[model samples]
Structure formats: structure tokens, C-alpha cells
Target: MSDAGKLRIDKWLWFARVVKTRSAAAALCEDGSVRLNGSRVDQAHKAVRIGDVVTVALTGRIKVLKVVSLAERRGPFSEAQHLYEDLSPEPPRFEPPSPVAEREAGSGRPTKSERRDLDRLRRPDD
Candidate 1:
């Protein structure tokens, strides 16, 4: 059993130092990047309970955790570390960067027009 209290998943993540900030946690949740008890939870204020399994899909990695305690306030690392138990295995190790894609024949920094095209490509089409 954990201390009795309700806390937001995002708040808990930030307070527990699982993420650098509450905003980051919220974004993760919104993007279906976070799961609680095996289901994706998209609300920043979704209540969290002790023993609940939390899964965070981060850049190229997944972090699994078991809720151990709750805290509303962001605190020192020592205090934050007490709030959760990491169930995730170490992230896979990788050697020096391998080329993920073949370079174009004349690849160079994007020109202004190319930058605009890049921005257009990045825009979410509705």
C-alpha cells in the first residue's frame, strides 16, 4: 500500500523526476506515448495510484515503472527517486552513429526554399 492521496500522472511524472517537466509528461500522454496499467492514457490530470504500472514511450526507448508513492511538489532528486520503482531494463547500447540513410549526391545545408519545404513536410495535415 502507498500513501493515500490522489495525484495527476503528469504531475507525478514531473514531481518524481521521471520527466524533466510536467509539460513533457503531458505531451507524452497526449501523443499516446504513455500507458497506465497497459492502456494508453492521454490526460494530463489522469489520476494515478500506487502499484499501477506506467509505461513511457520515449525517443527510441520504453521506460516501465511501478508507482510507489505520490508527490504533488517537485523536489530534490533524492525525494523524487522515492516516488517510483523502475521496472525497465537498461536501454540498449549502441555504437558510434551508423548512417541511417544514404546522403544525396550533393547534400548540403538546406537552402531557404528547402527549409520552407521541410517546414511544410513537418506540418500536420488536417
Candidate 2:
């Protein structure tokens, strides 16, 4: 790529395979979930440079990554992984799974009429 050709932040994130799609990256940018140099960036068109720190807030967790290289196009996993380095010192700890609700005993699968009744309950009066 030429010196003038630089990867956009959102495009880089997508090319890096950080998020599933380009739209997701744009959404993250619009939502202020993605930041550059400790400040939120509004436009996804911003150019990304090597060594720039990127913070991504995703699904109730935050991930920090450092841009290591620029990619103009989406590539294979090996190539994508080289684009950035995860700098989070620690992994997000797992929370214990919630307890399942106890079901009443002898509550066997409903019959055809019972199924209809359940479906009726789901519908609003009209």
C-alpha cells in the first residue's frame, strides 16, 4: 500500500476480524464503545497508525488492543491476527452460572389441547 493509503479505524477492525462485520464496527464507533488515545472517536473514517491503542467495549467487557500493522483488505486469520496485539493484562473473569428454576414434578409434556391452551395464553385479547 502507498503512504497515502491508510486503513480506516472501522475498516481495520473489520479487516482484523475483531468484530464480525463492518457494520458492527461502525455501530461500536457511533455508540462511543470504541476509543482511540483515551478519547472516543465519532467517525469510522479516521486513519489508524501502528502503535495506536484501541479500546473496544463489547458485550459488557472491555478489550484493549495495539495496532501492529495496517491491512487494506480482509484477509486470513493468520494475517488478521498480525494487525493488532491484545494488551489487556488480564482476561475477564467468568461469573458463575445462575441456578435453573425448579419445575413442578409430574408436569409431563402437554397434550394437543393443552398445547392450544398454552398458545392461547401467549396471544393478546383481540
Candidate 3:
């Protein structure tokens, strides 16, 4: 493709608001946390064109985006959103375990209240 038809991956990431800063995007690319069309991207200057799939690994989740358009400058979220079509899958739901006090009957040791009641019952008349 011609030069005009492509843009550097780092620039595109920043322009699309996928990352907070261009330097972060470059660091992500250098860290091999970015993938272009399923291939690892180790350089910030790699060229990306419309219709390419870009996968980015973030702290707790991964983002999959398809290039829909290119941008010339960083813009507002509404404008940036148009630059890519999000294809990321839904993140897994997390359900915290029930509290220890809510455990099933006879599952574990008695609670403090239970122990207090027991002690009261065991005490002689006084």
C-alpha cells in the first residue's frame, strides 16, 4: 500500500485513544504487548492500514480492535472512537467468595457469638 494509506501503529494507538500517550504506546509496542494481524509488534514505527486487527494487552484485560479509519491528530473520545471498531470479547465476570460468617452449617468453626453462647451455657449458676 502507499504511504498515505498507512500510519505508524504507535501514532494510530494514541490517535485512537487506545493509550493515554504516544510514549506509552511506543513502550507497549517495544514490550511486545501489541500484535498486528496476529503477529507480534516489537516496533513502534510498524505501519498499519485500514482493516487491520490490532490486539493490545493491558493490565487486567486485552483489547481487540479493527482499524476503521485513520486520524491526523489526537481528538476527543467521540472522534477517536471512529478510528477503530472494538472487537474485544467480554471480560470474565468475577464473583467474590461468600464471607466466612456466611459459610454452611457445620462447615467450620463456630463464630464468636456462637462461642460466647456456648460459654454462657456451660457456666454454673452464679
Candidate 4:
């Protein structure tokens, strides 16, 4: 559907909705967080076409996608998803850190010296 078979990596990413905006896509590329066909791509203008693979290091996640088609405009999620094949592996599950136990109310707050001791326990570097 695209007139041009070739597309800039940033533009493609934005059009596909992989990123929120063209500038955000450019920043992701400029920061050296994007890889094209296994090679690191630091420039947003790097050209991409069908069958190319892109690796994006998003915050707290990594996406591996294969280009399926080129999009001319930013579109809805359903439409944008047609542009690429998602090959990123499922993200590993993370368990939340355990919450610190709290002293019962009316037990009274710890004294200043006791508070310092608790702080030391929490921060070993102190």
C-alpha cells in the first residue's frame, strides 16, 4: 500500500505505533537503543524495508519485530500492527519486593536511638 518500499526506521516505528510519536522514535534510535538486522542503529534516518528485523530496548521491556509492510501514516493499533510481526519473547514475570513489617499501632513509635538503629538495619551502607 505504500508508494515507497523503503522507509526511515524512526518514521516506520512512529507510523506503526510501536512508539508514541516520531520524535520519541527518533530519540530511541539516537540513544543507540535500536538495532536493525542485528546491527546497532544510532541514526533515526536509517532506511528499512520489508523483512528487516528491528530490536527496540523500551523501558522495562525489549521488543523484537520483523517488518512486514510499510505504513504511510500513523494509524489505529489494529491497523498499525499489520506493519510488523512481533517476535519479542514473552517478558519474564517479576515478583514485587516484600513489604517491611510494621510495628502495631499503640505500641508507640520507636525512640530516636531506636529509629537510628532501624535506619542502619535498612541501609547497611550507613
Q: Which candidate ranks first by TM-score, i.e. highest? A: 4
TM-scores, each model vs. reference: 0.71, 0.69, 0.75, 0.82
- Which stretch of 10 consecutive residues in model 1 shows the poorest summed lDDT? 97-106
Model 1 per-residue lDDT at 19: 86
The list of candidate 4 runs beyond 4 A from truth reads none
Looking at model 4, report the run of 10 residues with the lowest lDDT sum: 96-105
Compare candidates 1 and 2 on lDDT and give the better one.
1
TM-score of 4: 0.82
* Candidates' C-alpha lDDT: 0.84, 0.82, 0.90, 0.91
lDDT of 4 by residue, 19-105 (tens): 888999999999999999999999999999899999999999999999999987788999988999999999999989776646778
List residue ranges in candidate 2 displaced over 4 A.
Answer: 1-5, 95-126
Per-model tally of clashing residue pairs: 0, 0, 0, 0
Candidate number with greatest lDDT: 4
Worst 10 contiguous positions by lDDT, candidate 3: 98-107
Task: Give candidates' CA RMSD values in order.
Answer: 7.2, 6.4, 9.9, 2.3
Tens digits of lDDT, candidate 2, 1-126 = 222446789998898888999999998898888999788988888878887899998886688999888876789998888888998668667988664433358998887987777667667473
Deviation from native of the Cα of residue 102 in model 2, angstroms: 9.8
